[model samples]
Target: MSQMNQPDLIGIADVAAKIPAFLNKIPNLLHGLKQAYLRTPNTPTGLGMAFEKAVLRNPDGNALLFEEQRYSYAHLNAWANQIAHFYLSLGAQKGDVVAVMIENRPELIATVIGLAKIGVTIALLNTSQVGKVLAHSINLVKPFAVIAGEECRVALDEIRHELAIAAGHFHWFADQDTQTDAGQAPEGFVNLAEKIDLFPKFNPSTTGSVQGKDGLFYIYTSGTTGLPKAVIFSNGRWTLAYGTYGHVLNLNQEDVMYCTLPLYHATGMVVCWCGVIAGSSALAIRRKFSTSSFWKDVKKFDASAIGYVGELCRYLMDAPPSEQEHGHRVTKMIGNGMRPNIWDKFKARFGIKEVLELYASSEGNVGFSNVFNFDNTVGFSPTPYAIIEFDKERNEPVRDTKGHCKRVKKGETGLLIGKITRRSPFDGYTDPEKNKSVIMTDVFTKGDAYFNTGDLVRDIGFRHAQFVDRLGDTFRWKGENVSTTEVENMLTEYDKIVEAVVYGVEIPNTNGRAGMAAITLQPGSELNEQDLKQMVSTFKQCLPAYAIPVFLRIQQQVETTGTFKYQKNQLKEQAFDPQKTDERLLVLLPNATEYCELTQEIFNNIQAYQYRF
Candidate 1:
């Protein structure tokens, strides 16, 4: 074959190798398509229905595995029914919102399922939230009642006086086996576990009235930008998850999924749980993710599949190699934010057969999944979406003369927008103004509207795209855009660098913010000249001239959100100012081969924009 035809032949061979896997996914894909396109309007389709069907199909099947306890479908359904009946007795009805503040436990899952059954919207509060932040989340939803787990009792009590909930509206449930009666119920709170037995163990009548579009969950964002916004998670969206991840991933009765991710996040609450319920499978639940115990727990439960976020995988990979890592039953892994650089290493190290990296957000309407077991891509999205050119400074889509957003070329990164339609409506946040801020109207036509995802992605052809970075995370340096995620991913490839958080810092007279990175070195490692030389060499070889970070702040540790996402707002606020932080600061001047301490003179030069790249 000619040289030009040689590459074509290789590409054909790659596709041929994947033909079997693609064909295996056809049945599930067809089922998902049917659910997405042929769903009945006003039908009772949601998590409640999905759970009910699973129970009916196999009430004796294992539903949840938490610590030493194994809950069968029948037992869990009975518990959920009793909770629903108890809520109804309290005069709670459809459309009422109930605040649920709990960690990952059987009670938390049961409470959400029970509330859905009774047509009451569940506000899944972040367990890490406390004081003013917790109060804001609870008040924003205006829940009729607040249910606190024994673990969160102290947090709830700290702000009980400030809550707007009525008297007798506070409820608490026991989560710890060792919790004393006194500790179980705080002041001015009723014990839900003690009262749940008083109600009947039968499905409530309200389940009949719950429709597809009804409110199911009010999941809060990470609040990295500000106070967490309560995003609306409708029953229809839950139904879609049931079909997509459940059927498309081909989960079955024998498959057990280990989920250590927090239940407040959409990936855990909706995606992982819905798939488990739809398949009539058991879920192995952990109170929190532990790198040391992760593989042991997977082995203990004999989990065939596992759910994760990028950071979870990173934590596992960072830990010393364990004997249990390769011998586990986890053949399929699902979730989002698996970085391209670590994807292959993670799969190879853990013996994962399928890596289903996905792309989604709590408030965004668009979602992509690696259904075909593809590497380094978020996978093919069947949903209607457009990748439009975006302006970094303005933080909006670049529009043409006719005021329509222009689509980027196949290989370019751009803003991702989901077309809003009857089938794929943007549920948006509870706050109307917040929804208005993200929804763009008349984008391509006079009547068109789209949900702005506020994420930059590269179109990688064949309807697949790779997540580049968040809109605000990408910064301009030397008049060229630099993706923080891309740079951070590269930085972590070096063995000594455990974590890297990249952001932009404004220079005194620069056109845009220069790149800065706050990195955490591996234990027993030092930021010496040799290490600096290696990092500089890697950056030069792997990144563009403008994309390399100009400043480096050596943090002993990196702060992350409850979901394991790096918190950059505080670091950005502190920047490289010597007074703001005590961490060692280093700088790579223009045309410099090594990093040196950021002295007063160098700092002043950077501030005054005296040095140009």
Candidate 2:
């Protein structure tokens, strides 16, 4: 958007429109903020306190809704309490890390809260992780114990020898709800379901002592070095999200929030789930996101709110329109990664009243929320943050001679950096050296530091901004920035393409890398002559000449991380090399109107600069 148009996106009236609700919520919001910032060991708001509040509010009311099960606040709380007492009996102590690996279910939520209530830092291992990655994540934290679902038993067994914990430390919960029928436990594994059955159903006394600074969960994120890094998410930070986003949702106990996203991710567990707990409402969960069963489950639960990521919205939009989709009670959505292109379309199609698209990182301090119900914005940060000029090619900030980074003007793009303070603390990676690499000291002044977000954002007016791209995924090309999102967006618009992952690939002797895309096509679609021509034509018509992907790799599916984020590093490493990958490669040559199969001869010529991109 232009400078003249930027002001129209959000203004004084927009903020004023939300003031009435804001005024009504002043006391609660203030209390939440106080709990978030104050470093109190007792009475510090955390997961245990928050859930207890909901349980006390209405114990008989629905707290969780899963397949064929409606666990009341009282029931879930009691179950969690029993689990807590059982672990406590086993000498579990506060501040001890307990690694948990479970798929999305009520069991997962209850298990985490149970341990968290006792002040144990839950190391949330991604369920999709297997073998080496799974073993590595567990050993990274060196947890005191392991609690896993029967579904994950094979994976745990595969890497059992690699783990540091003794065989007796492993506890198993049946894949099905183990409450009614304590299912058989795997050999040598303690049956948590059967063992905890005899424990008392009362809140642990240690709940009050979980300080604000205490680690709540350790979430693993992809690292620059190709391994996963454990990021600390403190009770303080989680409370900040709880108080901030929970109020933004403005849900009541009557509401139901449906979340199908992975629980291991912060977006679902901390953000969406907290919103439910904050409202003292029911949280309806699914094993996984399913387009076919989404509306069916929504109607079944009468869900008033839903959770989403960018791709989830797109998938829903693409699914055949059904009577079940529209006229539902789902009036709100809360999650990040909803692109500007689909923001309005998603709302209009689903009759959604609010799209609370937010931006936050488990590793970073600053967070942005869509407070004013603005469109296509990541909203504003209550904490201090700056968008500064950066060098994309050099992959660093462009600092002035005075040793201060320059802030981008409104309607300009720049790297986002959040100033670190007690209020906005960057509880970065567990690796101290890794943390040092991201913290920029002396950024704007002699005695200041800022956390690099590794993101490119375009500033709109009124403290709001639009997400541009991940700094690493975007590359400088032909003296211009080529974001993968830009190319990916254009490519996915084609009818044949189901998903597109774009990245920059180096050509021999080139000043900047050229654009390449790995695309997964629709079912029954093939890379035939006519389709290739139309795809190239669409690229020529819709995208910039330089932005057009010079190379294409046809893939059956795109690999994604546990959080549904594209695993681009692997794709970027492989590039479009025919020799490196057995997958078919195609290229659009100089002045070509259609894409053709890339052979060894064509690949060598391109490397030799026989054809210019």
Candidate 3:
């Protein structure tokens, strides 16, 4: 028998063993969901509308807690109203895209709700973005106005000279000094914080004016492939998705959700934002995630649930096992990208009983929810979804001569694709060309259409599927895509670099995947720290910070197959530590501009969780 066929995996005995414990915990959460439903009737409009009505009904109830500030439903509604009025005052009519660049604060949440309520579209900007890429992102949305925090002034200022936007189009929300009444904006920018303080709260301008089909927000895909594509999110889309997931996963009103992921991202927006709408208080961390302080923060907020991407899980798993490891009140988690290798360990260590491992994209109309609370599978989707054989080299779905696309067999790997139609529309980016790139017309039959997910997944049969690697050249980091082709193209421009093979490596404790590059030096050229730093810094100027490769491997010649495709599997396995492989490697320490030799002590420190992110 083949090595792969040698074993049938043992069942989740420990999970089955803990069935009673899991069953006992469900009743309280179920009760909370029931209460929320009873309190507010479901309408054609999304959860935000219901949530807004609920807020009005219970004006004094706690709606959000972030940093040191506690915002009541009344306070949040007032803030949202103020912002909605501010947009209106600035001539931001219905259907106008309002770009929001901020961290995970109450304002970010308020802005999303405010924009949604006013019939204005929000373009959620990634906080980690800087320079030309940041400028490009702003231009991509072509917003009527841009609302950014004071802290992001420098980043915006750096690219301001190049932007086509007028002085009046820029609006600043001074949040650096949150304690004092929100500060005034600098010259040429409107100060929303100052405006809100003086103005009385107003009702939603779009109340009864908007419907489920109206666009609420636009989230751009991480331009790993090319320029980012704006994915239009309507009120109905998120309402259905979040409501179904909340129902299936049993997200509740009393559950305090701790979210460190940036609110701009879909994971944070969906899980944390939806939880808030479901009558739960979402706890937001303003900055990046801290693995060491994770448990402490969770305990501090008394968080019953937390959202995660792959990297967050890995970071927590890398932390030293503590006697207080499972001491928190966390019961379940709802997120994506928990690898199979670390799945059991993460659940065991964190004492998570139910992990609603989900699989969905920003543009995908279909999504899978782990309804059965399966151990490793990203459960089933009620909508139309299929796993089809893919041609990795050509980067397309494979079809037989008979014109039918081959579906993955039970327990087989294939590319996951979702059928797109009027019912399952591929609510694509703002760009028409970019939108067309991923859509497959007449895919199976004469009239069928599908959206290519660009992800390899395995069918487990019984409506469950396990996530495999991503298709094509894109890799994920911090739940964002980092294109290997883009990175490789940038690296090859360096004087010393001849060829580059960029791929993602599994870091000890990190989200998504950390980037690593294996570069072949030009003949008679030498690689040095200064040159590396200069090249990498230049790349960072053009791309987002998360897309920067942390590890560099200097090679004489890159290995390739007969067809000349770069073999990334070997490089990914080798990573960037010289001790791990024969190739010379340099590791970039956190916040460091230059790369350094990877020593055993440094490696041990990284693995032992001594270093901070």
Best by TM-score: 3
* TM-score, one value per model: 0.77, 0.79, 0.86
Which residue pairs does candidate 2 place in steric collision? none
Error of 1 at 98 (Å): 0.5
lDDT (CA) per prediction: 0.80, 0.83, 0.73
Root-mean-square deviation of every model: 11.5, 10.8, 4.7
* Rank order (by TM-score, best first): 3, 2, 1
Clashing pairs for model 3 are 230-429, 311-510, 311-511, 311-512
In the range 327-415, model 2's lDDT, one tens digit per residue, is 68999899887767778888998999788999888798878988767888898778899999988655689989897899998888999
Residues 308-401, candidate 3: write the lDDT tens digits.
8887887788778875566898977888888878998888878888888898888887788776677778876767888999887676779889
lDDT tens digits, residue span 1-613, model 1 = 3334332222345656777877977786677667656665488777887789889987998899989888899989988998999999999998899999888988887888899998899999877666566788899999999999888888788888888999898998876632124235666889888788778888887787888888999987633334567888888888777777767668788989999988888888887887788678999999988888999999899999999876687678767897989777898888887767788898889888898878877777788887767788887677789999998755578999989889887677899999998888898887787788888888888999999887889886667788876656567554244567767876787888898888888766344567899999999889777978788887765555666788999989887555233357667788888878888999898788988899877888777767754
Give one clash count per candidate, in the order shown.
0, 0, 4
Task: List candidate 1 stretches off by more than 4 Å.
Answer: 1-17, 177-184, 222-225, 473-613
lDDT of candidate 2 vs native?
Answer: 0.83
lDDT-better candidate, 1 vs 2: 2
lDDT: worst 10-residue window of model 2: 473-482
